[model samples]
Target: MTISPQDLLAAASHSKAWPFQEAQRLAKRLPEGKPGGVLFETGYGPSGLPHIGTFQEVLRTSLVRRAYEVLTGGVATRLVAFSDDLDGLRKVPGNVPNQAMLAEHLGKPLSRIPDPFEKYESFAAHNNAMLRDFLDRFGFDYEFVSSSDCYNSGRFDDALRAVLANFQAILDIMLPTLGEERRRTYSPIMPISPTTGAVLQVPVEVVDAAQGIIRFTDADGSVVQQSALGGMAKCQWKVDWAMRWVALGVDYEMYGKDLTDSGIQSGKIARVLGGNKPEGLIYELFLDAKGEKISKTKGNGLSIEQWLTYGSEESLGFYIFANPKSAKQLHAGVIPKAVDDYWQFRAAIPGQDVDKRLGNPVWHLLRANARHEGADAPGQGETLPVPFSLLLNLVGVLGASATREAVWSYLGNYVADADPAAHPALDALVDKALAYNRDFVAPTLAKRAPAGGEVAALRALDAALAAADPATSAEDLQTIVYEIGKQPEFGFESLRDWFKALYETLLGSEQGPRMGSFIALYGIEPTRRLIAEALARA
Candidate 1:
C-alpha cells in the first residue's frame, strides 16, 4: 500500500482542499530560495485571554504552512505568533477580576497595565503567556514575539521611519473611514505621553520625518515632542497592522470575516508604506449557541479546556478544519456531533483515492498530530472501535454511576478486542462518554409510562424475545422487532415511530442505537427484563 512520489505529486496538484489552495497562493508569493525560507504570521491582541478564535487562527495557519512545504517540495517555514501588547487597553474585559483597578488603567498600553489576575507582570503579559502555553500543549510549532519588545528594542525602527515618511499617505487612506468627530482629532500616529504614559488620541501638532519625531498634546494639557521611533509612538491599529507586515516581512496571514474591511484598509496602507500586503484569508467567525458572534470579553464561547473535556484534541482540530469559511456554533452542544463527524471522516480515509484522501479534513489534522505524537504516519481511521454516537448511547444505557470496569465488561462482550491496552483511544473515549453523559445526558433522562397501545406492543415484544432462540444474531432480533412494528395491530405508521415509542418509554431519549444491536449488546434476557420493568413502571 505504498504511495510513490508520482502519486503524491499528482494528487497534490489536483487537490482542492482549502489549505492547499491557501498554500498555493503563498507559494507564488514567496520567491524561490529566498533567505529565511518563508515566514507565516498570526496576530494576537492581548486585550483578553486567548479563545477558540486564537486557536483557530494558529491551527489553520499551521495547516497551510504544512501544505506549503509539501507543495514546494519541503521549503522551510517559520510561524511567528505576534502579540500586540503595546496597544492601549480601551475597555476592561468582563471576564477578568479587579474591574475598578482595570478601569483605572484604561487608555494605557496593555503591557503597562497591572495584571488583575496577579499571574504575570502585566495584563498583556498574562494573556500572551497564556497564548503560548495553550499552543505548546497542542504541539504547535511557533515563535512568540511581544509588540512591546519589538517596539522598544528598535526592531521596528526602520518601519517606523517608513511610516513617518508616508504619514500623509496613510492619513489619506484612513481619514475617509472615520466619523467627523474622530476625523477632527485622528492622526495615523499616536504618541505615548511623556508624563502620563498613555497612548494619546490627541491631534498631531507636528511631524518630523527627518528626526522620526511626532508632536502632540498630552492628556495633562502639555505639548510633547517624542521620537516616533523606539516605542515612543505607535500607529493606529489599521496603520499598525500594515506597519507590522512591513516590519516582519510577513508572507502569509489570515484573519476572521469581521476584519475584511480592516484587511482592505491595511493593504492600502501597506502599499503606502512601500510594502505589499501579505497573502491573506478571511475565515468566518465562530458564534455562540444563540447564533451571535462569540466574544472573548463576554466569555460567550467554549474555551479550549471546556471543549476538550468532552471531545478529543483531534476532534477539535477536525471541527476547525471543516469548511472554515462557514460560521459554526461554539458550545458544549456542538462537541458530540463534531466528535461523531471526526469519526465519520476518519472512517472514509481508507477507502478514498489519493486525491480524495488529500481533500479529506481528517488527513491533514491526523497526520499533523500523528507526527507530533511521534508516529511515522496516521492510521486509516482504526483509532476508535465504535462510533461516538453509539458510545454516547451506550453510556446512556449504563447510567451515570456506572464504573469504567462495568462499562469495559459490557464492551468486552460486544467487541472481542476491547481490551484497554489494545484500544487506548477507545478507552479514552469511554471516559469522555462517561463525562458527557454525566453532564448533559443524565439530568434529562426521564423514562415514562407507556401510553395506550404501547403497553400491548411492549408485551408482544417481550413475548417475541422470549420465544426467539438464545443464539439469534442482533440482526435476527432486529428483524423480529421490525416485523412486530410492521403489524397492523401495533398501530405504528412506520418502524421509526415504533422505535420512537420504545426510546421514550424505555430509554427516555429521542434517539438511540439500533434496537437489534442494543438487544444483542445488552443480552436477550436483560432486554426482556427491561421491557417487563418499563411495563411495570406504568
Candidate 2:
C-alpha cells in the first residue's frame, strides 16, 4: 500500500490521466477567497431528451473535478449543470410527441412552450426534468441552473447591463462571424415579444445602456421599448454564452469541438463585458456508426435510454470516460467491448502501482465515490465478477429464458467471488446481457456444419476434455486446447483460423473469450456435448 500521503498530490500531478491533466491545467486559475476553490460549469440545451453527448459533458467534468480535488488536496469546487432553457425553440424534436403543437410554438423560448409530453409546465421543463433525473440517478454532485429562472428572476440583470454597456464591443466581436444576409438583421440583443411572447431577432434601433433597455421594431412592425434585462430579452447564442460565463463566474467549462470558433468569439465578448472567460476544453463530438456527427435533429444518435437498455450505465460511463478529445463511434455494436473494458479496468486497478493507479481510468472513474484521497485503498471500486461479453455469451449458451438463478449457478463456477446478493452491480449486468443477447445476439447467430479435418479436430478436442479433470484452471485448460489445435493432423494453418472456427462453431459469433475460460466456466462435460452437437451437424 502507498502510504506517502505527502507525495500523493505531487505524484498525481505528473500522472497522464486526461482528467488529471485537465485539472492540472485548471490549477493555475484557482478561484479566490478559499483554499482550492473552483467552479466547473457544463451547459445543456433543453431542446431534446438528454443524449449521451450531453451526459458525457457532465460525467467528464465531474471526473476533472475529482482529479482537481485529488491534485489540490480537497479544493472546494462547484459544478453547475446549467440548462439554457430560455433559448428559442427553432424546430420540433422528432422524438417528442405532438409535433404540431411544438411547430406552432416555434420562435418561443423552450420554457414557454407547453410540454408535448404534458408532464411538465413546458417542453423545457419536461426535458430538464429528464436531465435532472439522469444526473441524480448517477449520484453526480451538481447544481441544476435554469436560464429562464436566471433571466425571469433578474439574476442576469447585472450581466445584461454589462452586455448593454459594451453592446458595440460584443457586436464588434460577433458581427463579422455572420454571413451577409444574417449580418444585415443581426443584433446582439434579442427582445422577447411583449405581444406574442416569441423571442425576436429584430435589429435593435437603440441600446440605452444606462436604462438597461433596447428599442427594437417587433415582428408586428410596432416600435417597442423593451427592457433588455430580466426575462424581457435574451442575447443571441454567442452573446448569451459569453454573458453566462460573466454572470456565473465560471472557472472552467467544456464544450464540443464544433464550437471552437464560438468559444473564441464568446471568450472575447466575455472579456469585453468586463468578465474573464472561464478556462475550457473543446472536446470532439460523438459520431454515429456511419461516421456522421450524432445530431439530435437528424435523430441519428443513440439515446440515453437505448444505451441503458442494452448495457449497464457504468459501462456507458466507461465508454465516455476514455478519450474525450477524440471522436468515438457511438453505436450498439460498440457496447459489448465497452462493457468488458469497464470491468477489465476495474479489476486491473488493484494490481497497479501508485502512479499507474492514479493514471488508470477506473481510479478516476470511481474517485467520485472514493473513500479517501490516496490511490491505494480497499473498497475503492466495484468490479464485475465476469466480463460483460462472457455474460452475453453465457446468455447465448443458456438461452433467452435464462433467469438470474440459472446464470448465477454458472457464474459461481467461473468466479468464487460471484454472489447475487453481495454484487448487485454484477446482478444488474446479467439482466442487461440477457436483454442484449435476446435483441441483438440471437438473431445474428448462424451455426454451420463442420467439414473435413475440422471434424477430426473437434473429436480430438472432445476426447482431450473428456479425459482431463473438470476442475482444471482456465490457463491450463487453454494450453491443452491449444496443443490439440496445433497437431498437424488437423490441417490448420494459423491459430486465428482455429479460434475463429471455435467461435463460429460453438458460440455462433465471429470471436469469443479465451476458449479455456469459456470451457472452464461452461464445464468440461457441457463443452464436450457442445462439440458433439457441432459434429452431429451434417
lDDT per residue for candidate 1 within 1-538, as digits (tens), equals: 3455677656765579998888888877773636886888999999977777788898899888887877777788889999999999999877789999999988899999999999889999899989898788888888998899999999998988888888888889999998999999998888988887889888885467867878888887878777988888888999999999988888899999989999999999999888899997899988899999887567697888888889898888888898889999888888887887887887787777778778888878754521453111456656466667777776787785477887787776467786899888788888898888899988998888887778889999999999988768878989988988888887888889899988887788888878887777667887887788799987
lDDT of each: 0.83, 0.84
TM-score of candidate 2 versus the correct structure, residues matched by position = 0.93
- List model 2 lDDT by residue over 1-538, tens digit each: 4436567777778879888888888886672214335888999989977767777888899888888887888778888999999999998877789999889999999999999998999999999999998788777888899999999999999998888888888778888888989988898889999989999988885557877878988888989986887799998988999999988888889889889998999989989988888877789988899999887668788887889989877788889888788889898989999888888877777777778878777777776533335335675545676788878887897775577788888887788877888878788888888878888889999878788778888898998898898799989999988998898889889887788888888888898888998887878988888898899894
lDDT of 1: 0.83
Per-candidate total of colliding backbone pairs: 0, 0
Q: Least lDDT summed over 10 consecutive residues: which range in candidate 1?
A: 369-378
RMSD to native, candidate 2: 2.4
